[model samples]
Target: MEQKIEKLSTVKIQKSPDVYKVVDALNRTLKEDDLMFGLALDEDKEKMVFTIYRT
Candidate 1:
């Protein structure tokens, strides 16, 4: 008899402000190939936040 195997995958997501400085900083700090999959800006609070994960 024969068996089958499954492969694994990974993903990353991040959120940040719409400001040029923040975005530029994030880009500069992060790796070139690193992915910026998600983004969210809080205009009311006037702040930039970021979220990153891998799976």
Candidate 2:
């Protein structure tokens, strides 16, 4: 089946050592809902922002 995905929302993540864990959980939740997300890092690489997309 053809899927149409659209940008849903963006969330700013705080800097932390377990940042990967946070992203992983978000990914899992999104996947369960048949959606997807992308991550963007700041210039300093100290901050992360995730954009959630839905189909």
Candidate 3:
């Protein structure tokens, strides 16, 4: 069997209001598309970045 890797895209939210809130919203809103791949926090820049895989 052949395995394929999906392309990923990153989105940064500067001065994010709430990390958990954003994650919850994304999970809820994008559940159908299943776009969310992962999330990370940039302490230096004080930003939250989300990695989404192309579907």
**Per-prediction TM-score, please?**
0.28, 0.58, 0.49
Tens-digit lDDT string for candidate 1 (1-55): 7643232232232333344565456656663645332234555544544444321
TM-score: model 3 vs. ground truth = 0.49
Candidate 1: global Cα-lDDT? 0.43
Regions of candidate 3 where Cα sits further than 4 Å from its true position: 1-7, 43-45
lDDT tens per residue, model 3, 1-55: 8745475777787756667677778877885884656677877678877777645
> Least accurate stretch of 10 residues (summed lDDT) in model 3?
2-11
Two-way TM-score contest, 2 vs 3, winner: 2
> For model 1, what is the error of residue 15's alpha carbon versus the real structure, in angstroms, after optimal superposition?
16
Query: lDDT tens string, model 2, 1-55?
Result: 9879899898777667777776678788779787877777867787888787887
Q: Who wins the lDDT comparison?
A: 2
RMSD of 2: 2.5
Tell me the alpha-carbon RMSD of every candidate.
10.2, 2.5, 3.3
Q: Locate the minimum summed-lDDT window of 10 residues in model 1.
A: 4-13
* Candidate 2 deviant stretches above 4 angstroms: 1-3
- The C-alpha lDDT values of all candidates are 0.43, 0.78, 0.70
Candidate 2: Cα lDDT at 19: 70
